[model samples]
Target: MAEKIYAGVKVQVDQEGYLIDTNQWTKEIAKEIAKEEGFELTETHFAIIKFIREKVAKGEALTLRSIGKSGATDIKGFYQLFPGAPLKKATKCAGVPKPSSCI
Candidate 1:
């Protein structure tokens, strides 16, 4: 793990950049992470991020189809939101570990 600053807060992250502690997450941190990943955050992105965080906190497995069914956005919209890899990008921005289904 390595220490990184996001929105003026220092936190630990794994090699892949996911936060080592979810308690360290904040919307500002999410924005910084998103910017690093090549996109800007939006209300829609936050909505989806919130959903993903909640799911993970509750121990529910996340999948592209699960996110698509979230009512936040459909699959096409998810792809458009995160670009290259939706699940990976979304989980990273949400400050959660990369889902097992990712690779």
Candidate 2:
């Protein structure tokens, strides 16, 4: 694990840079992560982030197809919101472990 400080909080990250401890996540941290990825969290982005976090907390599997059906956003819309690797980037912004389906 590697450590990163965001919004004055230290977080443990995995080899792929996803947060290891979801509890350390905060909205400020999410904003910082999104900014570093050249993205700004709009309402749509926040909805997706919230949806991903909820699903992760439930120990559910995440996938592009599932996210599309999640009603948060359609598959095509998800691509528009998160251009490349929507699930991966969104999960990272949500401060959760990378979904197994991501890689």
Candidate 3:
């Protein structure tokens, strides 16, 4: 059996085994996604930060600007992709001691 899932949590397990739900979209699940994506959990913060930084950098280099300049569209995608790292806590997870490239 498995615990009841609420919101977008797609997985369920209760001393039995793993059962993945296709419709789920939660932080803990996202964390698992990143892990499956070849990123270590302990460094997930760094992973997301770097991922954001890279994507932002790529966007900026072409336009001779920065990630902060992308406007609404960019912001929306960022939120969707890294939903686990909420806007409020992204900074701490990024682990950029003092902010480095505006990700």
lDDT of 1 at 62: 92
**Model 1 C-alpha lDDT per residue in residues 1-103, reported as the tens digit of each score:** 9999999999999999999999899999999999999999999999999999999999999998899899999999999999998999999999999999753
For model 2, how does the per-residue alpha-carbon lDDT over 58-86 read when each residue is reduced to its tens digit?
A: 99888888888788899988888877888
Pairwise lDDT winner, candidates 1 and 3 = 1
On the 0 to 100 scale, the lDDT of residue 62 in model 3 is 21
Model 3 lDDT per residue over 1-103, tens place: 5654433553554332223332243446545544443443444344555554455444432221332344422555445544653442342233212233433
TM-scores, one per candidate? 0.97, 0.91, 0.25
Candidate 3: list runs displaced more than 4 Å. Answer: 1-48, 51-73, 97-103
Q: Model 1 segments beyond 4 Å from truth?
A: none
In model 3, pairs of residues that clash are: none
RMSD of each: 1.2, 1.6, 13.4
Clashing pairs in 1: none
Score each candidate by Cα lDDT: 0.95, 0.87, 0.40
